[model samples]
Target: MIDALTVALGVTALLLAAWCGFAAYRDQPTKDWHFIGMAVVALLAVVQLVIGVVRLAGGDDPQQGVAIFVAYLIGSALAVPIAAFMSLTERTRWGSATVSAAAVVLAVLEVRLYDIWGGVGG
Candidate 1:
């Protein structure tokens, strides 16, 4: 289950980053792909919540697990919806900028997840 989640999150991050990069290049409006990417990321994040809680309950305690896990889940859940709404409010390059923001946050969360799994010295 952990491996599946890691793979899912990693793949979603890569795909979303690629889409954001492409959007940056063209200065075009968001397509369905962005929504799809965000949806997938959000789903994976929910799955991660279950996994994290189970691990913590099982005595497989991670260093700083609670804070890190909560932050990661919040970050993952916020990125896409916030970006989409913010982008809609502005009908310009700022929309693409929102994508960039979402991509960076998602990437950061991915790293955080990795660090949490690895414990200290990550």
Candidate 2:
């Protein structure tokens, strides 16, 4: 995986989390701008996923193990989309909370992924 891209994704996730957290704190629902931010994060995740898979296919393996790395990749890629769907269902401040939570989770997952790549255990 590309180190800079992974760092970018992790930072983006935190930023998204902060944005949604602020919205929830203000008693607001997930707004169009939040959705756009989510989309951008998700797009980054997808790109990472593709790159990871291609690298794997080309015989590059993570230090931790392929299974765990791929799992994190897929999970990170799906996190925002699932959260966005759940947010759409609620249409309340709680919806923003859900997105915020997901964003935080994604950030943590990205960090974990980096650790795994470097053979560090959680």
Best model number under TM-score? 2
lDDT of 2 at 89: 99
How far in Å is the alpha carbon of 14 misplaced in model 2? 0.3
In model 2, what are the clashing residue pairs, if there are any?
none
- Alpha-carbon shift of residue 90 in model 1 (angstroms): 2.6
Worst 10 residues of 1 by lDDT: 113-122
Alpha-carbon RMSD to native, per candidate:
3.2, 2.7
Q: Count the backbone clashes (under 3 Å) in each candidate.
A: 0, 0
Residues 1-122, model 2: lDDT tens digits: 36677889999999999999999999999999999999999999999999888888988768889999999999999999999999999999999999999999999999998977773321
RMSD of 1: 3.2
Each model's TM-score?
A: 0.76, 0.95
Clashes of 1: 0
Candidate 1, lDDT over the whole model: 0.69
